[model samples]
Target: MSPPRVETVLIVDDSLVQRLHMVGLLRQCGIHGILEAVDGNQALELLSALDTLPHLIVVDLEMPGMDGVEFILQMMKRNVMAPLVISSNRDLSLICSVENMAQALEIPILAAWKKPLTKQHLAEILHHSPDRPPPSHSTPETHKEASSTGAHELALAISRHQLLPYYQPQIDLKSGTITGVEVLARWPHAEKGFIPPDHFIPLAEKHRLIHDLTLEIAGQAFAQAAHWRRSGVHLTVAVNLSPRLLDLPDFVSEIDALLQQYQLPAEQVIWEVTESSLAADLGIALANLARLRLKGFGLSIDDYGTGFSSMQQLSRIPFTELKIDRSFVHRAHQREHLRVILQSALDMAHKMSLVTVAEGIETLEDWKLLREFGCNLAQGYFIAKPMPGETFTGWVKTQNTRRHGRRGS
Candidate 1:
């Protein structure tokens, strides 16, 4: 049976036939509150006249006047937060680019599909709405955490030792086993609850405290890995490397000292770096990266496709892993262009002999698809959301039990 459908929908297309076709599909899927507009201008006028916004907006990329791209830009300027389903007869790559554009504009895009939409496509789009609950139990708390005010508050929080590490397990696609985890920093504010990393991380960077913040977080991560190792659950702990830390001359030695303090093997920890970060003081960063590599630590190029100098980074740094960003992984199975790009990325990584890690595997279809693509590692909400360190062992045990049961069955 189909899930509870969206209540209202607005379909904008230059073609009356196309609009009518989408209307029919929506109605067939149990959506009755439907609105139609001939083009982007008309759609905006209609939207302005409405007392309340529709639950969903379906748009065609090719329209006569005020094209879909312009309309989306206008919507962003006007601050319309309604989720969108973009349909186009244009090149799938162009549609994919527009999807990325909309997301960059902070608009919630449900899907970007080719024209002549099917009921199955609409169903999947509506099913994956931002309003829909996350599949993971711990996602709500982590994603909806309280916001922090400014650098002052963050600095205070840091001094109080409120920042801590949350571990999200990365599964080996071939073995279907948890081989590693990415250590994400979380600030559980005393009065405000969980303060997300976005709030404090930049503050730390801007305020020149990133060095201290990274070490604090790294120390906690190393300690956690030691605890896990002692428990007979050996896993590689990956830590995000700040370029600001790279600027510090003692950064590499500081990290080495932390590893020694915990008695953890250098090979057990991986440092994940972003391309933009490495662009900061390139000479120093390169030297630091090479030093870390020589010390037997693993290096990963994170958010692979999003960086402007990704290929350049690959040529310069000895990256042991390539983490494909979530944008390419989320709905690749449904979009042909995404699948092509994802496979190309995996192929390139394989050719370079770098382990490929797919981030943001949020569905069973994505999980199966990554396995088929032979992605080395997978991490996202579908596997398990980042959780408090205390619960990680239990989560691993449960996952092991499920894996064994599946094998037996």
Candidate 2:
């Protein structure tokens, strides 16, 4: 078989050595048509001059003038939709901030690597490039000054209902059917488009706004679930709850009201709480959770294995589901240790009569392995990315048709 077709790439960094290093790495990945820029300003100039733009752009975060974040903002302004890869030696949190900013600007990020770039990382980025859709060119109405941690801005976003919930489908491996959708929050800012949860979630938690934000998401999710039910497509909607929310005096009552308002059965809603969240003040958290369970809402321990005292939490919390973390599920098919961990999690869940869900099953191999391990449900990009409610019904239809077609064939 021949190698994959190479695409034109642009490397924007102030250091000559770094540019050369990246160039060599790209070449090793069979990529050519390399373009160079010293800074964001220079990169912008180069982009304007070239008739054919690069398919991918590698950038350094801390350039002297018009840094990576500024460059991405400029690119968004000019409607440049090339995928971006941030190669930096800065702190991981810093790199993540830049990635989130780019995402908010609607830039498609291929990958973000901490400096000392490797050939393997470059190859993986190249391999994944063809499958990624190009960034959208539609511009946000205005561009607000980008802030790394904007807690006040997040409060405003929540009040404005900009913190939208996007649904990601969870599939039943045996039946090949979409069992439900997990409601993941996304901030569709008037200026930044869609800001990810990581950017503002912690801030919300810190400012005691987490409960409000989560309820906002739950309200929207319940509304969508009601819509689907009315349309003859019943789907359980899962929403992650913040540990802080459990401390609220009327948390269960608030959720009960929301369910009643939407006329959605509590059974159709799943509240996913991470194990770490349960580690804090489990006395009250457990009480609140028990009330939710008694109300008929499905409770799940999200990211099952990554937290402290997971088994203890599972035994104490009235959880109906256990979701294995992605770290163990991503390559469980090839690695015996990971497979063992996954199998053990599944076994534990089964013994407890809890439904098992494997998160981040990104490949067919992992999905098959999870099925063989008797995972009751699965969710990840392999199943479907989180999507807007407007398009979710249609996506479910397509998935159902495809599944039926496969079975018939």
Candidate 3:
């Protein structure tokens, strides 16, 4: 086989030791072309001066003068699209805040490492990088004029039925069989092509259009599930629930109506509520959730362990599932502490009689690890990317055939 291509990397840190440590790690990973910057200003200067930007940038959040947030803001302002990996010894909350800020700024972040970075983490980042093209590269900037749409535009898209549901399959780790699929919203604009949900979901919530959007997507998902049932797939469908939707007085009734309309059993549908969303006004959220559970819908605490009072939330709410966030699941194979934490989470979920689903399983190692830890289900790029209903149906058929073939063999 031919030698692997060497990736160009840029490392920015205020400490010489940290910079040198990163250099050593990168070189060990077979990355030869590496650049160093001591601060954010210096990094920006290098970025502006370079004829070709590095494939990846490793940055420190707590710098002497120009901090990581400022550097990320500057990068966003300049429309720099290189993937960033945040490496710091800071607390997890602060690191997560920086990550959330980067996402808000639309900066592509490959991964974040809590300092003392390792070769395994670097290798994992490189392994996942090929699949996630910088957003700019994945989608052309030809429609710059129509790129950023406002709430009015989003409402119009909803009315026009432009927002659609795409399905990502969840697998049973033990059996390696497809179990369920998550419903992710996608907006395919005529001018801009596919618009990511992160771009429009906040706008929808701000404009009171989220309710309509959620219902529309749920309707499509239920319809698809019904079709699959008739075709003998019998797959469960999960849809994310917005906190605002949960607060609506008639939200439970609306869900009931949707299930009744589709003639599908409530047990076949899952309503996923993020832990962060549940942290606000739990009285109402819990009530809605309880009613849904009473009506036979599966309730999952999405992105488990990312928010405050996760244990309290689990104790108070009637959640039937716990989804370990991608951040923890992705790194469990490299970090023993993370692996222990994941194992504990799985143990807790099992003790509570809740199904465990690990998100963002990118490699076979991650899949195998989750199975070893007794996780019930796994989802992410490793199994399949989200696809339209038609494409998902085809994928399900193929998976079934493969399973049968293995049995026959």
Candidate 4:
């Protein structure tokens, strides 16, 4: 009455001798089916041609034409997910982390290793990953597989604290004035032109890289705001809080420390949480929201109507601002009832004494409709898309300058 054995695994490297050694180890470990690839391309080809992708991939950093990094980048684009181990004879250099680059691309990696794959090493990876291959599509994708030297170069950028924040404006309808700005993240990897949040944010989350990334964005935003303060421009900065970060009980306390460290007013900071977040732990969410609000921080529901708990979410959480999701606003005119939906949302918010903000005002018609319907504020392409913090500050100054110019004229 012995248990059934596990399936085979694929080992990708340019060296045949190393592959054979790995095959021997797998056999000893009771993994009978062993597939081999001399390099990333062949490995990928074999993986695609197979009825089922291999149970695991053991990648080598240095390979022929399409190296391990290039292979990983391609793997990310295709969404070919599998637990990966970076096995190389050399040390874990800045470059080897590229295998973990999938985290940034939302591909997950199990572990990286030095050459001469050992049984104990296999045991360690298997202990945690006995049932399923680690979800490679999780955050902080293997860095070793991103681009030529991209693994090392990207590491340098992050370690050197070069990641920066850009800002998108949120308007105020009551005074017809520029209000706060949402702090959007930006990293100009020398090789990867304007790395999108879709590419990096999730990776940061998957690998727990979000901790550092979040701190960096918070610090940078505060510094940018302090600079504008000297120039007489003060704007509230809103940063999106992911469910991963919010789940931690200390999340609010951490923000408290950040505010004190940066000498920024709690009133000057706004935190945006999605509807999905409100549902995760309703009790925790309400308690944290109340704590943040008590400390003078602003809280808003982002993409409000999209989540399943719209009614319950609003009722349970006392959010200061209700954001009408862009999806509803975009189709409001067509569905006609959608306009009614927007009106109902507004009515509900007002009944609760919560300010309503309309997002994604892309067209003049949408703008006119929202303003006409008493939506408290409008923000989207029509107002302006997110931009660099400096650019936004300058825009604010320029607008004031123009208003002054008109008065004098």
Question: Can you write out model 2's per-residue Cα lDDT over 153-262, one digit (the tens) per residue?
Answer: 88887888878889999999888888898999988777766665666788788888998899899999999999999988899898999989887669999999999999
Summarize candidate 3's per-residue lDDT along 50-134 as a digit string, tens digits: 8777788899999988988899898887878788999999986678679878976777787877998888777777875644334
* lDDT of every model, 2 decimals: 0.87, 0.84, 0.86, 0.75
Weakest 10 consecutive residues of candidate 3 by summed lDDT: 131-140
Model 1 lowest lDDT segment of ten: 133-142
Q: Residue by residue across 347-376, what tens digits does model 4's lDDT show?
A: 888888887889877666777777778888
Which runs in model 1 stand beyond 4 Å of their true positions? 2-5, 132-148, 190-193
The per-prediction tally of clashing pairs is 0, 0, 0, 30
Return the TM-score for each candidate structure. Answer: 0.90, 0.70, 0.81, 0.61
Model with the higher TM-score, candidate 2 or 3: 3
Q: Candidates sorted by TM-score, descending order?
A: 1, 3, 2, 4
The regions of model 2 sitting more than 4 angstroms off are 1-29, 32-125, 129-149, 407-409
TM-score of model number 2: 0.70
Query: Which stretches of candidate 3 lie above 4 Å from their native place?
Result: 1-7, 11-44, 58-81, 85-107, 111-124, 130-147, 278-283
lDDT of 2 at 277: 84
